[model samples]
Target: MGDDGPAARPNILVIMFDQLTPGALGCYGNRVTHAPTIDRLAREGVVFDAAYSNSPLCTPARYCMMTGRLPSATRGYDNAAYLPSTIPTMAHYARAGGYRTVLDGKMHFVGPDQLHGFEERRTTDIYPADFGWTPDWLRPDERIDWWFHNMDSVTRAGVAEVTNQLLFDDEVGHQGVRALHDLARDDDPRPWLLVVSFTHPHDPYVTRGRYWDLYEGADIPLPEISAADVPLDPHTARLRRVSAMDEVRINPDDVRNARRAYYGNISYLDEWTARLTATLGALGVADDTVVMLLADHGDMLGERGLWYKMNFFEGSARVPLIVHAPKRFSPKRVAAPVSLVDVLPTVTDLVGAAAPAPVDPLAGRSLIDLCAGDPTVEREVVGEYMGEGAIAPIVMIRRGDLKYVHSPVDPDQLYDLAVDPHERVNLAADSAWSAQVKAFREQVDRDWDMDALHTDVLADQARRRLVDSALRTGRVTPWEYTPPADGSGQYMRNHLDLNEVERTARFPR
Candidate 1:
């Protein structure tokens, strides 16, 4: 904001979406769906080909990006998991380095401390910030119908001009546009970091008629792999029971409608992308802004007969990561594997900010080198899931061309992406790749104590359940954020000079 010329610290804009997979975008090789704005960013930016959500669930994956730590380290194992106030986030780091940090939409933060270091949170979160959604590992067979996702999102998918998600995202976009205008007018000397996160194309697949008609009569592709095509592993079988997929009779139409609605929402988000970036250009700050786009996690969208996220499958785990800063770096595609945890370090590196050494050491390495076209950067990504549909902790390590999934209760799964991209065959049991699988097994053993992690998750779940039950018995005080109103000082208030206010508010004056 100051007159530091080319040496001025760049403003950072992070645009994030929920339950969006790389396969849904045109730049990621989806020919059916239309997302021209995002495609333009990818065409003129650094695109990471194999970026994944460290944890496939919403809250855990978000926490991983916010703290640069894993669920095991942060104890943020589920949707209701709490992130302690002590953990320093990218917001805290940016604010410390003389930046105004603001959050416009959903971060899925749980517990009493909602704004974990954000200077200004523009909107209240869409999801509950309490422990009501905690998963009960003690009763693994019991399903909480109120909170658990079911086939209703698929079977009842269609055109809707209004939905709870649509309403929330609309406000998020409006607030983002207003925030940019306010930032342009503010007298604060510090550069700003704005996070405009949208919860879209996530679930309850529905969209407006205009977006829905974009794919009308267009042949939509079905899932390449079906549940019947391969034998179900223990985890996949558990997921089926958890989502109540076995109860519903899904026909071809149900899958088609759901995919259509999901694609429509993708276009909706693309529109917002165009709006926000265009606002930056109108404010004459586009050249000094670093725009990065990513997602909390990916949706299965009925891929492999799975919907929503909570697994290590490519559809659920892989996310779109693109950094559009032609002024800072060249446009190129990096094939190296990365994950959500790397976001914190990468952002800090980009803005020349500092994230103090965390209590639990950060599990991510900075991707700035990879964005700069360094071929020797690490290509490893680690993932963990200890949330619902699991009786034990499951972990995944993707390195080079192979992905290894391990859980104490289920059989190991090994897939070589170089050969079998769809993961149809499980090479874990094959004697030919025994040595590589053995190496992966040993690495898992050294990296994690699965038994201990399982016990810890169970114990935390019990504590949260007990606390939630006790709190619901009396007058409940909700933890949801409520933004403050500043009506007295806004617009043409008599407290300030009216002419000065008008002069500052008018852009391009």
Candidate 2:
């Protein structure tokens, strides 16, 4: 550990993945995937077994985590939802607390203000920053084929040495390594926070031959509950059409191949995780840094006829959370449910940083106490989805062993995870659980005005659509981020003294 004084703040490295589910990780009990680095981290860190994404979509989930608020509070309704520049993020708080904040990869920021609060952003986002992906609840049945997920990702899954996603993640990994080396050499006095996020194991499920060959003879199991096994719910039925599942015919071979590729990509990310952690160790910052691993949300991966995330099913919403700070926290597994919204506050607490008084009440409390095994902390997780899969707001509350999902249009669902871990039975309809159902419904009524939220979502969608149309009409300036580079600052520059330049460039000074 560093000095106990207030001036000695530890660096924080947050390694995040896209659409990574706990079910696929070996630490979380999947025997097939090869993630030794992650497994080792699990052994040394505090693991939250029931961690979930507050929102299942990309933009809203990232926004909620960054702001320590829920989707509705930020008005981050969907993929194209705009986050106003005025909102304070985790980076803002870290910077305010005298830490150097940096982001090395994808954050899915969906507006012109790309650098939310980071002092430096090392890579451009993988997804677009425009409002072109805004969902219209008015036309709930239509699928935006151009951008919406489809069966093609599964039907065409295979091994590839280089893919768009792979290339992006390669750069993400390289930049993160380079940033750590640079930070080690720099004379900056402040502790640093670097978010090394990757866009992989997400979809189109392709991986390098090296990674794919790792699972050559391994047994890849199919989904426990297949589409043919159970009837689809209303939201999943809508997701099926949204993702164009009905238009394509997927055989068992396609499913197996896709699963194999997904597992391989996970191995590929494991390799990156090794690289980042190794760099931290080589830089001699391993002990003085706190490492966190999590994901924005989980991929359904052909669970119950679903592929991508949209609903609050355990497969889609459950994320893997590991906080590795052995010197500061003892290793333990926390079965209590936690959510992505808790990230900002937790990071603040981990670094001993003081966040500015929040503009609004934070939806999350610090998990540091819980990481240290404090039992008095509440064990509840709240989630809301105003994304493409539904016409109305869907809210979820996970308390103790029960998970209750509610929406105005569809029938409510209640699952007792203690006894029925697979969520096979819906206790909401059982006469014996009527009181429990009513309590959840009343809690929903007390917390969310579903009707008002629906109206607000529709209005926001209309406004964004109008703005998108106007922007596309003429000489369009894209909101897509392009990283800046200064050519004159390259090696052996004409303006610098040769000896000093070489001395400064070399490490181990």
Candidate 3:
């Protein structure tokens, strides 16, 4: 940690969207997506060409990004896995360093510990807050179609005036803008850290009528790996079962409509990001704010015949990361590989705050130099998947132009991304690449004890299921996280609500 001065520290705003793959953006070389706002930010900011989520699922990925620790070490094995409240997150460190930290949207916390260290959390989570989503390793082939992912989201995708995800995101945006207004007006001297997370572009592959019309009759991008050419890897075949892909028959029309709606949803998210950034300018704090944007994980978007995130394919793991702080860092593209786990350290670096003293030491470093267009040497991006689609601990290592995926039960995969960008060829078992595969396997063994970790994960799942069953005796099933005094404490931004603000402020007079 380095301290410049109290006043020198800038306010940090993190805009995180769900399931956004970087390649789909206009700045990332896609010519069809209508996301001009994000493209503008990429032009003005430091764009990481190879940024990934260390954990390629929703809950585990957020936990890893929050704590700068690996999923296994944090006990964040699955979506329903509870992150112990004692784990000191970045918000806690920021607060200790004299920053007002706030969260305004989804984090997908499964247990009762909602606010890890945020001073304020607005807009309760769109997903559940209990162990209802916990997966059982004993039943590997059983498809939990009731809640687990399915093709229905893709098969029945289209336009709508409003949706479950749209309303939640609208509220998230409303509260986020209001929170910014309040922070601007408040007399607090500390710097601020506001994370505005959104749940859009995630599911049901739908958007509003306005955004849906943006891509009317547009030629949607189909799967890169065609149906006939899709080589079935072991892990991918498992995902097919977990997602129930075989249960439904999806035609080319379904693919076109789903891709159209997904692209439309990205445009809507771009509009949301624009609104937040425009508000920063409107409040006259644009110059003193440092804005960063990334996603927890990425959507396959029908790439390689995959829909959503589960494996460590570039489509599912790689995400967009852009950091814009014109006063502190230069604007350029960094081609080195980075991870979401670096965010905590990056924020601490930007604000001159010391890293949090955690139960386990951090494995991430700050991206300050990378933002200055200087990248580290020998950058290797590492990620793990203990969520769904696997019974064993799945690990992946990406260094240079090569990506290595390893698991005990599945066949090892090695791909030279520079030569074969689509990962169509696996050089794992080839004798010519035996040295690379051997080195990567040795690293995996040193990094994790797969057999012990597997048993521990099973035990942890059993304990959680027992607790869930006992709690369901008299308590509500599928507990939702609704914060106290929801929406009643929001600040007034419009003239229609001015009297309400005044009335609430002048109470007991």
Candidate 4:
């Protein structure tokens, strides 16, 4: 961090939660665990009621949020698709606009170029960084057993003092607190952007006693449609087989316990958010920082018998987003549909980055436009699925009150969300809604070239599989991010003056 008069530039804090659905949060109308901190955030910030992931899988969703590009545009089709280093990210924009960017948790980047554009990233990502999770689109019936999620993660969910995810998130919180302390130093003059990503509430749904107790005796709701009554469409049936959902039976108690733990995990993250905001206030950086709260994607969490994300359904594709900056932006709820890809231009607009070239096809628009009490023009939000459960491209378009899902091989699903909130009925074949379906289908045709997309997906899959096999042969090195250490220059050193180091490290002058 260098330069001068940086206090005029606002600091940006992005709080990213993993796989926590908006419908489970207290602010979003859940009666499960009481999440006062996050609820308070919604009270003071602009909460987006319709925020969706461009692609629901971890790697592709995160890439969408980072670069403000759709998965189709970037060829980010699956979890193992490597993010090309050539693309400029939100971090790159921030750097161009003179900000110190840092990442503290799971970004799920699956390539050799791990950092993307962030100057420092504290914790290693939870998933593999190579092409290990690549899906074989060639073999639709063959399930990739090792990485494909099963019902075990759902049935085995319960309380835990310390699970693998708990340990990782705890360290993420620790590093985040430390990063705050580091940011508060007067010696560092550049405005900083700290992205504290937590891998929680994602899977193996477990929580500590403190959070678990918060949901005790509370009414934890079950999925809208149980597995017994699960309406299996052609695409959903494919998802069930790939996930091995038919192998296990989830009793009422198991569903209750799992939902209870998932709610508890949301509360657990609330405590973390409360502590971080308190830290910002303690460091006297609250007024100069604009905080954003969101998730990469949402979990189905047994919703409609779907356990994980990869579908266009509301439970899996929609995420919670709250932007809080009372000093600069007013508080108001926005019902307009937006995407994670919007985050890039929103951030770049806030920080005044070097603008993208005129020909750049970016899907993101500045959220600042919404802050000025302007009317929200009706717009369409598009999402796609080229991941594990599909042999062909699955595309989704949400416009106004209708949601249309198109799978190349399967029959399309059309739902008027205003009338059917649960997405129980598909109007694609209904004679009454034939005109609406026809209109959406026409737009789908205009938006995508299905034949070309299918070819591209298979080509990328074959290329990645070959590369993965070759890399596994001999002297194989993981592409996992190993953070560079700052040892001698920090704390104490035999050759340097300790007092000078202490003074420079001290915060608040």
Candidate 5:
């Protein structure tokens, strides 16, 4: 270990998974799934039990992690919104400090400059390619293209099937391994920051033959829920719509199968994580690299009869955060609540790089001090989720054993996590804690205003409408809406029109 006085610099590898919850991991007391790789990493490093995503969605959470600010702070609050290029990213800071940065897998960035702060983007992401909003142009040998053209063929053949007919997790794992191998051989002498993102356990829960067979006979446990449960917020109602569970009558078998598939996907992802860790060790940089394993968000998987994410529930908000710093940092478990916004500052601290001034006075604190076992830091964390449609906004604050959820269009939700960890009971109407509920409401108002929080909602709607109109009209005309420079405008103007033409030609109307 370098001298403890602050000159130490360590290479950083951030491995992020999509829609992975902490309770699904073997290391987090999940007996159903065997996540040996993640378990080993936890044993070697610090495991944060209460780590959370700032927003319970992919693009927003990633934007927050990249900027060290909450999604609401940057006005990038939804999946459809783009991250403004004006913000400085940790990658840019590392590059300024003479480090070589490369990003592989999915960044989920919308716009023309998909590279964001990274010096090199090694793979074409699944987000831009799959979504018709972006251009059809793809790199010759992009990993996403490889999946679409090759791995998907295996999926179509049904040789590898899991929950929702998704691709095998090993396929993504192999891709990450290949990327790491290339990074290890790069001629750059400067320390490197490599980001490997995996789209496993997210959806279409399909896995390879062996992985599927591993969980074939295992009975997947259902999420804890009560028959009397009802959404206390409009945001939760919106989530119910997406999950297709708002109907009064539903098929129980379908729900059970979906949950089983989700768990199977999680187990498959665990195996791939194991492979990723082994590949890192084989590359000889394991000891010198600070490996952080986390998720963009989590899946509901039938929690309260929900299938997807984007609610303020603990099942969707809480995520897995494992940080394996080289032997210099003490290894232990941290029970404090930590937000994804802390990622950027934490990485900067580890590499001894200068963090830029706060854009919105960050709601997160660096985990570096926590890693060193600081006792003065607060254990409370706050999170927010804004509905994309007509539903009212929701804000959640978790402090110690209490959780407060405020919704503009519905009754407030208060849960004593220590007493009701599953959130089966709601104590808002009880006369005893009316004072506590009022205080929580006041705190929410002081921290944020639901009406004023949605600064970019209209702008986002305008951009989406512009793109959709272009796709429909097949003509690029100037509009009141301006597209993000990351080439989204040009892509929308060119590719979406072509798609419309193809569709019209394929099926004349």
Candidate 6:
């Protein structure tokens, strides 16, 4: 063993994919996916089998992962909210510890000073200031006015129909690869922490011709959807309405087509990840790098009549997490349930960095010991989804073999995950599984109280707008709050006053 602990202090390369589920990868044994690179990573690294997102939505999940705090702790439990500046983020800690931190691709940051703790942001985001939907919050020149203005033209004329020509393509994988190549050439004396955030496998599911053809003729499975599958709880019923999969009531063929397209996107991301890894190797940094692969959250391709995310279902909450530590940690599968919040502490622990003073209690535990192959240790992962509009709140707890989901609007849901991995049967109302359901529900309630997950001014506003938009327009629009141009800092000072007006007028608090 080396006394210097060379393995303990390796360069960190964190690669995150947007909205990718473990089930969509070949390493997870998905028959339809052609994700060879990700599969190779799994073979070389420690693959986490039951890793989950603290929250199913994007911003909240990313906030939890970056801060080592629960989404509720940051009060950024929705996509529209901005990450608070005060949180002790992973990048900040790494930079403070003398690591050169670089961020490329999407961070989904909403306000000025979007760089957060990263030393540099290499690429401009493809998403508009208002999360790619509206131009109201963007600068006059920076707004995506063309997308909206030419929407009719594109729809009518099929203009720009070439494969992989979309904005996300330019910003995510390719930009991330370029950033890696650039970072490799940097002569900075300090070790580096590089974040390559890819926007792939997200919506508008477009990929290059090579990736698209990789999954040709692959049979994709459709989710189980039946009227009898309805939960006895009304809260779950409300959640089902907000779940995008509800709109996909088409035939089996259409479902398969959609699944194939989603797999194509995943494969596209895999190719880019392979390229990034190759770049690292070419720079002679592969052996000294600790590469961590994870998704901010998972997506429900069509599981149980759920599409997209923002639910407590397994397909939505469970994500793939793989950590390839430099030689010190042996490759092994971690079956224990883990959350994205664990990411911050794990990275901090690995890099020998100090966390911020007055750091809030972390909801996640470091996986270092677990990665060392410690047995007899287990963890229960919890997830929550506060319905945007009229949708009821959904809470889930997964301990081991059983998973319980509580809904305020619909019937409570219980599944014997060990027996029915597909989650085809609900045992909540079954008297035989009453004890299991009760125990899981109690565990969930205790966890919620422990984490202080509760409704607040911001959460309330989020819920109202989310529900209103879902009910009225059938989609959630990005938040459009703009700061003043004069840089007077008055907007930040008077945020409460502005938010009051916004809550009351814009979202009808």
> After best superposition, candidate 6 residue 348: deviation in angstroms?
0.6
Q: Write the per-residue lDDT of candidate 1 for residues 1-509, one digit (tens) a residue.
A: 33544335788999999999999999999998989999999999999999999999999999999999999999999999999999999898888877899999999999999899899999999999999999988788888899998999999999988999999999999999999999988878678899999999899899999999999887898999998887799998889999999898988899999999999999999999999999999999887888999999998887788889899999999999999988778999999999999988877776583534445678898888988888877678999998999889999999998999999999999999989888899999999999999999999999999989999999999999999999899899999999888899888887899899888898864
Worst 10 residues of 5 by lDDT: 134-143
lDDT of 5 at 466: 66
Please tell me which predicted candidate would have the highest lDDT against the true structure.
Answer: 1
- List model 3 lDDT by residue over 283-388, tens digit each: 7777789999999999887877788998899989999999987667767988888998899888888668343445568767788878876644557788888887
How large an RMSD does model 4 have? 2.4
In model 2, the clashing pairs are: none
Error of 6 at 199 (Å): 1.3
Residue range with the least summed lDDT across 10 consecutive positions in model 6: 150-159
Candidate 3 residue 334 Cα shift, in angstroms, is 0.9
Q: How well does each candidate superpose onto the true structure, as a TM-score? A: 0.98, 0.97, 0.93, 0.96, 0.81, 0.79
Candidate 1 total steric clashes:
0
Scored against the true structure, residue 195 in model 4 reaches a CA lDDT of 98
Which pairs in model 3 have colliding backbones? none
CA lDDT, candidate 2, residue 477: 95
Report the C-alpha lDDT of model 4 over 1-509, residue by residue, as the tens digit: 12452234688999999997899987888866678999998998888898899899888999999988888888899899888998888898887788899999999888899988899999898889999899997788887678888888878888889999999999888889889998787476888889999998898878888888987788778788765564679888888999998889878788888888888888888889999999999998887888999998898888788888889889899999999887766788887888898898888877763534424578877777775547755556889889998989999989898899997799989998899977888888999999999898899899899999999999999999999999999999999988788787778898888788788787766
Error of 1 at 205 (Å): 0.5
List the global CA lDDT of all models: 0.91, 0.90, 0.86, 0.86, 0.67, 0.67
Over 1-26, each residue of candidate 6 has an lDDT whose tens digit, in order, gives 14565555678889988889888887
Task: Show pairs that collide, candidate 5.
Answer: 111-486, 112-486, 112-487, 113-486, 162-206, 163-205
Give lDDT: candidate 3, residue 384.
Answer: 87
Candidate 2 TM-score versus the reference: 0.97
TM-score order of candidates, best first? 1, 2, 4, 3, 5, 6
**Clash number for each model:** 0, 0, 0, 0, 6, 14
The 10-residue segment of model 3 with minimum total lDDT is 1-10
